[model samples]
Target: MMNLDAVEQAGEQIWQTRKKMNYTTLGLTVAYTVQMLRDGEIYIPEYQGHIVWSDKKRMRLIESVLLGLPISEFFAVKIDEEKWELLDGVQRLTTLDAFLNNDIQLKNLERLSKCNGFRFSDFSALEQGKFESRGTRVVLLLENLRLETRLDLFMGINGLDKQATL
Candidate 1:
């Protein structure tokens, strides 16, 4: 049988440990984020799942950014001093990655319908500048966080979204 005093002490220790974890919020430009993805500095875990956004959905998100609308924030954990593991915003990041790499073309955009069928390479210089200038907010769990804490945080955040799973 478990000792009651020992269990209470263990629980207190866990609570104190968790209180010490630190996090930081940053606003990163689309250009910088895409560059990091290309360089493989951002880790996309398998649990975040595949890129499932349709062309229309992807296009809409891009249009929102160009229109300076607020997009959802991303959650990531620092893997090291130089690398980050993305916990949320997989779909958003993957869509941007694909679009920037010209692997996917924008289509059926509502606000920017004329941009349909155009790859990032086909964008005018001004359009490219606008796209790159847009920024997204990121909440980073510092490296001091335990792996299990990070995983729990990821699950808790994603579980509330109907589109995400373990």
Candidate 2:
């Protein structure tokens, strides 16, 4: 038979433990986030699954940024004061990385179809500036958070029924 008292004790312990976790939020620019990705300040773990977003989806994300729309927040865990492990938004960041490096070409954009074939390099200075200047919100899970908690949070966020495409 199940031990009801022990189960309640365990639940209480979990609630008490989670009460001590810390987090912070920051609004950072797309250019800054991309720069961090390129510089290795922010990265995905090898175990974090592959990038599955299609090219058209990627273009739509970039289009949202360029058009000043609010993209979803990125969630990351602090590895140190200077480094972060991306828990959410891997696909979005990977798309940005691939596009910025000219590895992927933008295509099939609905409203911005005129620039469909363009890579990051193809954008004019003004267009590039607009793209880079847009802000993306980030939520940082502080270093004090335990690995199990971080993993649970990551899994919970990713396991949602309606996955965030942005």
Candidate 3:
């Protein structure tokens, strides 16, 4: 049988943690976010590891954005008044960076097959403008949040689920 006292204590702890979470939701343009990444204002936590997204995966992300699909919200925690750390969405952010900066050649795309073999620079001005102006939703965790709480949130939200795609 389960220990009732232990269960009660765990429930109380969960309540306390939930009470302490403070966050805000905002939409930022793709160009703004990519610039933030380039300017080093947004940092990817070491726990996220390196970029593991393949070209096909990256291409699909770009295609989804071009198609105006609803992409997942990015989760980040404010490290200080001027800095922020990415807690989740590393793959998506890095993929955007790689594609927007023309670091990778996209191919084998199904929906946007016409974009095959094209880098960011090769896109028409209208297509590039559309991509740059796209809105991306983000969840910002305030700096008051404890590191342990941030990790717990990350694991609970992302570690248990398979990767999300549109």
Candidate 4:
């Protein structure tokens, strides 16, 4: 079991490592769109690919934005200085990805294009404003845990709801 200090140290180290990686899909164009769904990456044909965000979810996000709510959430992940991978909260991260790519249309927002495994990013100017205002957050946890740990974080945040991960 990890003590408080040890856990804190582990987390800090992970962040340091993550920063070192300096990950940003910013300019990287997506050669293919992969859906990080409940099963895994599923390539979607241009015509078939669609944002999974339902009306309710998109509406809630829009309302939160209109209300000036902050929606950044960190996903805790285990770390290995040599080889790092997601240890938890991959679903929310995946969802944010969908939003970033402009997959799900916000109340007034529209769908953009898709990127990577599952990122939608190609949108009408009007839609962009709506979702951008919603403001989603990504939280990454640093700890050397395994799939079990990742599952725990996913369930913890999802609350018994089986969420998708990209």
lDDT against the true structure, each candidate: 0.80, 0.81, 0.81, 0.42
TM-score, cand. 4: 0.38
Q: Considering lDDT, which of the candidate structures 3 and 4 is the better prediction for this target?
A: 3
Question: Best to worst by TM-score, what's the order?
Answer: 3, 2, 1, 4
**Backbone clashes, candidate 1:** 0
Provide the TM-score for each candidate, comma-separated. 0.80, 0.82, 0.84, 0.38
By TM-score, the best candidate is: 3
Candidate 2 at residue 164, lDDT? 34
lDDT of 1 by residue, 1-166 (tens): 7799999999999999777767889999888887887788887877666547776678788779767887799888888888999988888988887877888877777787887788889988998888887888899888746666766777788664434553
In Å, residue 88's CA in model 4 sits off its true spot by: 6.8
* Per-residue lDDT of model 4, residues 22-125, tens digit only: 23221111111112332233212222122354555655543453345665443434255433343332333455455665565544433321311222344455
lDDT of 3 by residue, 1-166 (tens): 6699999999999999777778899899888888888888888876567437776677889889988886789998888887788888888888888888898787888988987888999999998999888998889988656766666667676754324210
Q: Alpha-carbon error at 84 in model 3, in Å? A: 0.7
lDDT of 2 by residue, 57-143 (tens): 888888887678988999998989888999899999887777778787777888878888888889998988888878888998787
Cα lDDT for residue 71, model 4? 52
